[model samples]
Every structure is written in structure tokens, then in C-alpha cells.
Target: MKALAGDLGIETAVSFPGRLTTDELSSLLGTAWINLHFSVAEGWCLSVMEAAAAGVPTVAYEVPGISESVVPGTSGLLAKDGDIGDLTNRVTEILHSPQHWWASSRRVVESRGWDRVAEDWERYLTVVFSSA
Candidate 1:
């Protein structure tokens, strides 16, 4: 992780192997200057959601679940899907611009949040419970 972070010209930290706790991870994410995830495929990115909840600005590759997770130019910046250069450019854009950072912080909180997710879940559960 450190090597990759270094290669990307960013600072990195890791949790104890096989002992990665969500709260611990969230704490680390909370302190991050910026949270970035460049995965090629994701069914659903809980990490991005968590980072947004932590009020951490995020940068990620624009892919299937990613678009749903990170609201581009708001909660986080997304590189053109399948374009590495675009990813790099988006990251650079966010890192260099202070206004973008503040905007992202607010966007993440307002848009992508567990509160909203939980409400959705609750609605679904309510329907299920009513049927039961």
C-alpha cells in the first residue's frame, strides 16, 4: 500500500493485516487529506460510501458501482472510465484546487450518506414487514 501510494505521489497508511476493522479503517479515512480508490471493478463500493460519511473527499475511477457511489465533481472526482490518464487528471484537478475540495466535502455529506441509504433500507423493510 505504501509503495503504491508513494508511486502515486501520495502518503499511505495501512491497517494490521487480516485485522482490518471498519471503525479503524474509517478513522484512518477520516484523517486522510483525500481518499482515493482506483478499482477496475466493484459491485458496490462500501468504502466510497464510508469515506463520504467521514466527510473525506474521494477520487475514483468512473466504473459501474463507482458512479453510483461517488457523485462526480461533488462527493468525489471520477476519471473517464477505462482511461488511466483521465483518472490521473481528475486526481490532480481535485488535489490542486481548494474550492473543489470544499465542494466535494459538502457534496458527499449532502448526497451520498448512510442516513439516506438507511432510510431507503427502512422503506424496503417496512414494505417487507407489512407483507409479513
Candidate 2:
């Protein structure tokens, strides 16, 4: 990986933190401009959710679990699965325009969180109990 980065004239810093605490992960996410989720298969990617919660948009493939969190052109952009060219273009688009980046960031920050989810769940439970 280092060799490939060097060949591409990119700098890379590899780390093996092993396990990161929630606070540590949050701190790392806070400093990121964007997050890249390349998972071909995932189950409700918590990393992507955490990135959104931290106001960091994502560039991800249009796949299950991931699609639920990243709303294209709102929270971030999505590319066809396995399309590296489209993924690169989407990422470049986000990086090139500060206005677009800020818009996406704001959208992500304003999107539903745990509080809203819990409230919705409570409402559903109440309706179910009352019906019964």
C-alpha cells in the first residue's frame, strides 16, 4: 500500500490502533472532511452513521445498508457498485467545491439521529398497544 501510494505521488500514514474508544473514534471523525465507505456488503454501517453524525459526508457505493444512510446529493454522493471511475468522480466533485461540501455537511448534521429513531419507535409501540 505504501509503495502504491508513493508511486502515485501520494503520502500515506499507516496506523494499527487495534481498538479505538468511542471518544477516540469521534475525535477522529470530527477532523475528517469526508468519509469513504467501499464495502461491497455491509449491515447498517455504523461507521457511515457516525461520520454523518459528525457532519462528515460520505462517498459510497449504492448498496444495501449503505444506501439507507447516505442520501445521494444530500448527505453525500453514491456511485454504481464497483465503479471506481464514478466513485473517484463523485469524491472529486465533493472536494472541488466548498459550497457543495458545506451543503452536504449541513444536511448530514440535520438528518435524523438516535433521538428521532427512539421517538418514532415509541410512537409505533404506543399505537400498537392502543390498537390491541
- Candidate achieving the largest lDDT: 2
**What TM-score would every model get versus the actual structure?**
0.66, 0.77
lDDT for each residue of candidate 1 in 15-107, tens digit (9 for 90 to 100):
334566888877676666667787988877877777776767678887898878887777778887678888788778777874557556666
What lDDT does candidate 1 reach at residue 126? 100
Name model 2 segments beyond 4 Å from true. Answer: 1-17, 98-111, 130-132
lDDT of 2 by residue, 1-132 (tens): 567767777644543356889999988877778889999988887787778777778899999998887878777889999999999999998888745665566566565776777888999999999999
- Cα error, residue 35 of model 2, in Å, equals 0.4
Each prediction's number of clashing residue pairs: 0, 0
The lDDT of model 1 is 0.74
Candidate 2: global Cα-lDDT?
0.80
Stretches of candidate 1 off by over 4 Å are 1-18, 98-103, 106-132
Question: How much is 132 displaced in model 2, in angstroms?
Answer: 5.2
lDDT of each: 0.74, 0.80
